[model samples]
Target chain A: MPDTVATGPGPAPSGTALRELTFGEAIREALAEEMRRDPRVVLLGEDVAEAGTPFKVVKGLVEEFGKDRVVDTPISEAGFTGLAVGAAMTGLRPIVDIMFGDFLALIMDQVVNQAAKIHYMSGGKWKVPMVIRATMGATRRSAAQHSQSLHAWPSHVPGLKVAIPSTPYDAKGLLKAAIRDDNPIVFFEDKISYAKVKGPVPDEDYVIPLGVADIKREGRDITLVATSSMVQVALGAAAMLEEIGINAEVVDPRTTWPLDEKTLIESVRKTSRCIVVDEGYYRYGITGEIASVIAEGAFYDLDGPVRRIGARHVPVPFSPPLEDATVPTERDLFTMARQMCNK
Target chain B: MATAPNPATTGVEAGTPLRMYRQMIAIRLFEERVNDLYTRALMPGLAHLYIGEEAVAVGICEALRADDYITSTHRGHGHCLAKGAAPHLMFAELLGKEAGYCKGKGGSMHIADPATGNLGANAIVGGGAALATGAAYASKVLGQGRVAVCFFGEGALGQGVLYESMNLAQLWKLPVIYACENNLYNEYTHYSETTAGDPVARPAAFGLPAETVDGQDVRAVHAAASRMVERARRGDGPGFLLLNTYRFRGHHVGDIAREYYRPKHEEQHWMAERDPVALHAAWLVSEGLADQAMLDRIEKEVAAEMDAAVEFAQNAPYPDPQRVDEDVYA
Candidate 1:
């Protein structure tokens, strides 16, 4: 826990500089450490072993862990997800890799009805300790099918825990915590941030528990609550706002299900204005839920109605300019924050 | 793919057939009690009786060890009972009492008991297939030598996940068995109207050793199931068993007006000519395994046991409202 502060997002306040790792390397380190720690943990997905996924995040894992531990499954989402649920119930801790977050629709029944409810349905006799690692975010010209952030789907389910890590530091720690948790967790990684994002990670093991919020920056004028890829945009917008005299604080609620409402409400109460940014759709998505929580918890302390910014309702287009327009950008957050701050 | 083996070569002990006969009777009587509870409005929800298909569950379950796993279907009372579930608690669950296997959280359709390896009865048509296959995968990975049996009706053949699971099971050489109880009809409609091509060839295409047996014959079912179960225990991969049988009763207890889909003569013919319990009883008597008086004694004993179980369930208290949300998370 002591090293967590040193390796967390942003620069180290003190002590020696830690080695920097890309978002992909941090995730791979977390998986390798967990697998070495416990024999029960097994990884399975399409091309996960040899091909290392299209992102190359898990590229040398099969060689280190062997094909048995890092299994490459056929493209049967429902089948393997259900299999992971059963394997979790019986003994082994399974990590199911759903290549894209958009394919969650194909495995909803297995994840929601079976994996999520197995413990309650069995009257506490069984527990599913499994993690579903999926990729979210768009903008690589993959079009509508492969490019939607569907984290809101699992967030609405009762028994599932949803984790969305933004920084390489949080990615490693939070993924480690998710792997060791005793519940079914859906961990969504921002595909666009895999290689582009870099941050300090310790050589030792650490876990950032789910449901805790991290304040990326401190300010007094306004508070911006962001998640996953939006954290970087919110930080950029905050930096832009500081130049214009209005200071903005950025808070990331890393996990949506076990949401850190206390930190969000307290920050909003301190600043007296709030804006929620997420990569999912603007309508009936995670932004609305978090915004409502802050509105109810810090209603009396607010200076204005809590605003929400998220992905546009339109499907992510294949064209670069059109695709870029659908997602929230730094300028969108800056414009919204300036309007809220009356600057 | 091979045909069903000779029942005599099934390696069943001399007393096993008599025990199988008694188990079949117990299932028949248990279903009768369930029907009585439904008719009197004592039970809360739908009850799918395994009255005619008793041979399938008892036969397959008898071939399994207490530690081996079995995934059951919606009409799962017979499977649960054969797999060693306490009848009193099973009845209590049907009546929504606190003493049930799932503490009344899961009703007749979802009776799960970890002690006997009854993974749980899934209400969705083919929902438990992947769960069984997954358990087999775990067994293989952990070197546990445990085998899993998935029991489903012919209606499950329409579910795509079943095929997906089968493909994975065969591809991985998982130690699981697909026990398809083809009771002629899918709910009210015949399977021939819904299922295209030969059912046997389906698993054969996946390179599984597919076999079919008369589900009404307990010895025949036990014979084929034992071979498959042993093969799986030896890590020889998955097998498929198509159980050709009939559903003598309606789909559910409330489906009494089945004359719209099936005629009375067909029902009577199955009841009289192909009753599994009656056939097994007659075979037992003819084989000198037991006489008329002994069969009468067994029936009387099972009837009394069911009567007491129903009474216990009727008298048991319902689960407390405060504990409704207790098991939502671990």
Candidate 2:
């Protein structure tokens, strides 16, 4: 297991007092600290300055950094995102808040074509050290337009780095590292987990390097490789598995691209059985990519086929029951793990 | 909209007009060399020549400072040269040599040099508008006091992002100039068929100070661009300059047959009467600025320079095959 704090409703590590912070608060703290540290870092999005976004994550950043750095833009996703790419190219390290992951469709040209390829296209003469922070996950009752886990889109591109944070600690540290990184990165926050999830966060500045996986709870029976919002589901399933004597190891890749393939392969090697979980589509999604990696790396070590669990291949519905059914739940994982292990 | 048909006789330094004349010739000779390379199948890809619209690029870019930023379109050789890029480097880039700008990654459509403040030529129509606007936004936020000029064909009027960028630039009073070169055609179709309503009204609706000038007259373009550049530099918002010109050649080098969209007489009419180079040279000789011998000597010098640049690019080495994976990330 990686040398890190124990997560998932666990007790604090010995001799270290960790402060409890909500996921939103952790994200806000990261932005605040980075902006204070680097004057070039600026935040721009709709209602980001005063309204602090609908989630109230950045409620008081404008009061501290003032309006120049914490700018509020019109509802022009392509325009501002394109501008942010250019701004990042020239001087400023812009953090473009894209509101929702579904809105990524609108700014695909800027993100995929412009921001991601600027460095390579210019023969590495230009650097787009920018972060596009957008929300993902489903079951929000906001319908398909507002909810999506589209981190796979940027991850598919070559130059972009994709970060998917699972908890408050990972959210703060990974976001800080995303801002400081030289390449353009897409940071996908679980909208559902912003207010619902809480975890221990250190008071001082820290950077959880991208591509490092955190094993939330270690076990030998099986490996539950998860990302973003699914990390919580995997942990919950791990708890349920413990009640039966099936010990499931929960591993959060944290970042989809620049993926911690070593940790994932090593976990699969130890467990011999694996299940990949993600919030993106089940068909041709992150689950398939990770499942293939496990199969390729630990082909001989595996006892059976590596299974994949993800959101159903459909638009997330508006109704509560239907929306709930669209996404993979902890119970679904627990049932799948039991069947796969023949428990 | 105002039009000055003739080159101005006053209010310009003696050497300024001569330099402008030389720059326009340089662009013309460069395009000639490009067309030659394309015809011989020596250049890998075709290029959109900046032949007839040299006056607009020369005039506007002459008004910009060395540090000011400019975003160009696919037909951007004139803009790049006017902004001080070396001819040999540009030819090398077009030929995909390792010594080119962008290290041969970006070809003719994307010659970018930070030293010259060229943000890169965009192959996508209207793609560079927001980028230039963003540079202006950065200039405003960082107090750089630099003005950014976005150069696009009139065809970009159809793109919504152009208007979006203009609205933002105006709202923030960002130092940007939207230079629309109305070359009268959007690929094969005439812009009038694709564009509805007046072009200047679009920017004017966004509260931008818009003006239309005679693109054939380099002095008029220079004068108008200078005023707008100064206005933007002094904290005034962006301005839209509509350059009413014509495309002397087809859209790209491969687009030779013009009977489909354009008539023979029309092309002949523009080339014979409204050629910006011929018009400027005639005015220069008539005003006693230079004789036929001096103009011929300028053309000779530019022709020789372009010849040497083309040869340099022809002999330059291609990038190593193993280096294909390089520069993928910073």
Candidate 1 regions exceeding 4 Å error are A1-17, B1-15
The DockQ values of the predictions, listed in order, are 0.69, 0.68
The CA lDDT at A88 in model 2 is 86
* C-alpha TM-scores of all predictions: 0.95, 0.95
Real A-B contacts recovered, model 2: 0.63
B1-330: candidate 2 lDDT, tens digit per residue: 111111222232322777788888989999999999999999988689988899999899888888899999999999999887889999999999999988899999989888888888998899899889989988889999999999999999998889889989998999999999999999999887999999999998999998899998999999999999999999998999999999899999999898899898998998999998999999999999889988888788778888988999999999998998898878
Provide the lowest-lDDT 10-residue window in model 2 chain A: A1-10
Instruction: List the lowest-lDDT window of 10 residues for candidate 1 chain B.
Output: B1-10
How many steric clashes between backbone atoms does each model show? Answer: 0, 0
Shift of residue A161 alpha carbon in model 2, Å: 1.2
Which DockQ value does candidate 2 get? 0.68
User: TM-score of model 1 relative to the true fold?
Assistant: 0.95
